[model samples]
Target chain A: MSELELQNKKAAAFVSTETIDGEIATLNLGPTHPATHGIFQNILQVDGERILSAEQTVGYIHRAFEKLAERRPYNQIAPITDRLNYCSSPINNMGWHMTVEKLIGAEMPKRVDYMRVIVMELARIADHLVCNSVIGVDTGALTGFTYMFQEREKIYDIYEEICGARLTTNVGRIGGFDRDFNKEFITKLRAFLKEFPKKFDEFGALLERNRIFMDRTIGAGPISAERALSYSFAGPNLRAAGVDYDVRVMKPYSSYQDFDFNIPVGNDGDTYDRFMVRQQEIRESLKIIHQALENMPQGDYHADIPSFYLPPKEEVYSSMEALIYHFKIVMGETPIPQGEVYHSVEGGNGELGYYLVSDGGRTPYRLHFRRPCFIYYQAYPEMITGSLLSDAILTMSSMNVIAGELDA
Target chain B: MSEFATKIKDSILEKYNNTSYELDTYGEHNFICSKNDIHAVVEFLKNEGFIFLTDLTGSHYPESEGAEFQVVYHIHNLAENVRFRLKVDLAQNDLHVPTLTDLFAGANWMERETFDFFGIIFEGHPNLTRILNVDDMDYHPMKKEYALEDETRTDKDDTFFGR
Candidate 1:
């Protein structure tokens, strides 16, 4: 057959030709597939191994968190924010707090800003570890994943030291942390910083240049920078497309301007490039953390806002002033100015933003979370249109579409 | 407004006559346009370097006379690192605005999400189905009229506690 004839023949095979060989099969990827790791279904129209089209059904885990946010006070919303991107909850927590602070005009201390940068960067590392290792696991490299989890748990240990919570860490308060970073947190952070690179590099060495890994991901589900920006891709996904649009550099928040770090970029927005960009971003995050810690200011960890800060239990019991302040703090009765503010942070996979609207009430009038996973997942059908089944799964994993954020 | 904001405002107003802008509650630029010209204004903004649509969400204010339903679009210009917010408000009866999917492919899901939450219809959307809500849901849950409390609860009846 001629080249044109073969092309036409393959095109006929995809259409409804009324032959058993040319039959189109419907495959349900998941509302609960083990590969998906979350509760959302993609009804894929397939011709044998390659996917022709995919229609997704999200909202399986929709908790109506936004509507719920409408009834809760500012401080009470952090716990809810933690659930949006569970892999990097501290960033979400801090993003929400910062949005509220922008509304109330709370000036954070330099020390508070540096402390937040430290916690946010650690959360970024933790977020990337789950995503990139899962990419390795999908590519049949489980050992790298298993080892990376150990490093991720060390991050979780650091979180436990600071916030006393592991996964959904509502790490910091509005102006800053509830308490200063204790000696144990500092020591554990120092130790983790020293030891993390060795394990991380080992994991990278296992898969970064491996022939099999590259073969699986190098050309699978590639998206161009124009399409990526049109789809509103953010964070590492957008960076992988070579836009170099990191929120930290584009619009520095939480004193990110004080630190110096590189914004890693990749040419093709494929699974491989996404994985590599995240890998390099982990290094960049470490650099930012080092900068923050080295220049850690010597003063209060949180800002001096009496109403915004919850008083100590001992102080609340003895002093009348502390008692009233504690009541106000617990009730979230600080006189918040009626305003709208939007603040974003560079999250694990992309930009996580919080858009807040207050009506001079105890609760927020409206709150919207610009979840990167939710945005990136919109381009999934286009990305995996003609890819193999395994590559589709790899693309999904590489995108890191957390169901909580997607259905939030 | 800053000189740059005046430039942006004047540029948009130059092409489209019926448009206005003011500093939002956060002291950021918020351009308001009629629902009919939202598509044109957004296209103008896109041409003016506000191409990256960071967010598109809807809000409801039942008491606000003409703006019972408001759709907010947050766009960013990557090159200049500038952010702009565009708002298109619709009355309670005529809750329709042209879909931005043509200009921004990402607006599809966001439009569905806004429609699902606030029931503001996005005209010409390819598939305007409920995104983050169940397909069979009757009411838009984000509207203020839908009380957060579960009305079916048996405990703590106001009549039993008081009069």
Candidate 2:
């Protein structure tokens, strides 16, 4: 009797429409839903299709990176930065390197600066491609996402040539890169730069002015410019809201001052504007990379810091000074100045800042990562209050909130 | 320092008229004020067009007696392209500070994160719950007291590692 009853049980039992009323249904969007693209859960108070309110519950993938950074040496912390905003990891790695560079008062060569600019811009292009294509995927255009992903893959190939790792790339060292830009890396980058614009324009044509894409994104989940500033919106999201405050342009780190590029601002801070802002930013990044490559200087790849940069591995075993320097690098025996510094770079999503406090120790006394995704995600519930359920998904993707960075 | 930055320092020094307000220029022009004057100082800075609150975080210094925690606020004046730091220190016993959510809407989450990590309570934060860690976890992990190593692991002896 038990077996027969279990076999006869229905998959889902539905309540009759007679029981339905004006009551608000609390809908859980995701701890694991396909549309979320990350581990984000929102308990939504919904009246049928329209969202009355949403209470976002983040921290599903909190790795305690700041806590971990306190224990690791300054050089070891680059890998941890890579995990934050994994979509465009080189920016985080470079930003971390630049932070320590600031702490040590190290000067990078112009060639090193230009190389960093190229890598950072490539990371930005890769990041924007993923964000824009995923926006299309959210609006039911899967073709663009699958098609442009290969182009993103090409950028990762360039990363692989540079550092022998893709995705979470620990590309550069503290003062500068571990090695110069190898020949294959340049060739791949040149090929990518040549091919990226044509294919990227096709991706834009697929979603930029498409009737279906515009309707899904134009009026969905908008924030005013004043409200965006109050919330500390940054990067493309802030630019989409009509504020032209780019850290690269404002602060001008790593020779960003040398390059001339326009910041693409939008009138409405809606999903469409965010997407379009990123699309135009990708083109600007391309322009910056072209300038950096054409004007690439001839000099040493990394700054000549005897105590900082490691000697060649072969020399480490052959020579005594090289061995001592290697130990100094691995164990971090160099005397760090006791100071506090705040260094930020325009990350893929926004201003990724690192605030470090030192007591002249091997590791940071206190370290805080100002992840942009964390700031942008808190504004989600306010953004999607009265929007349709489908529009909420588009809003999340358009905001480009990576869960790794958000919960770090 | 720029003329405006110098003006910010002078105005704050004149307004506060206290020895505790230290305008130190380490990286950015850090206006170090006591916890009592943090609210007024931040409000003053905001009025001077340093309105964008770029980042707000805390650091724990257990060895520093009387001043065990410090909340650092980084604000940027976008038009002028000037940035400044406003620091307020609190003793370990009383780790409460006035909330900046009234001034910057983004301060809500940043303050919650600071609270989650260092147990520095923002007095008027609407929902001052944990943001990055699980709820009901009693200890704040970012404090210096919490060692990152696994105390329970028998293989990695502290004596062997020269701890």
Local accuracy of candidate 1 as per-residue lDDT tens digits, A62-168 = 99999999888789999998898899998888888888888888899899889988998899998899999999989888998899999999989999988999998
Candidate 1 Cα deviation (angstroms), residue A125: 0.6
Q: Let me know the TM-score candidate 1 reaches against the reference structure.
A: 0.95
Write one digit per residue (lDDT tens) for candidate 2, span A23-122. Answer: 6688999989999999999998776776766788989999989889887889999999989999999999999999998988899999999999999999
Give candidate 1 regions above 4 Å deviation. A1-20, B1-4, B152-163
User: All candidates' TM-scores?
Assistant: 0.95, 0.95
- Candidate 2 local lDDT, B70-149, one digit each (tens): 99999999988888888888899999999998888899999999999899999877789998899999999899889898
N/CA/C clash count, model 2:
0
| lDDT of candidate model 2 versus the reference | 0.88
Best by DockQ: 1
Q: Which stretches of candidate 2 lie over 4 Å from their true place?
A: A1-21, B19-27, B157-163
Alpha carbon lDDT at A42, candidate 2:
93
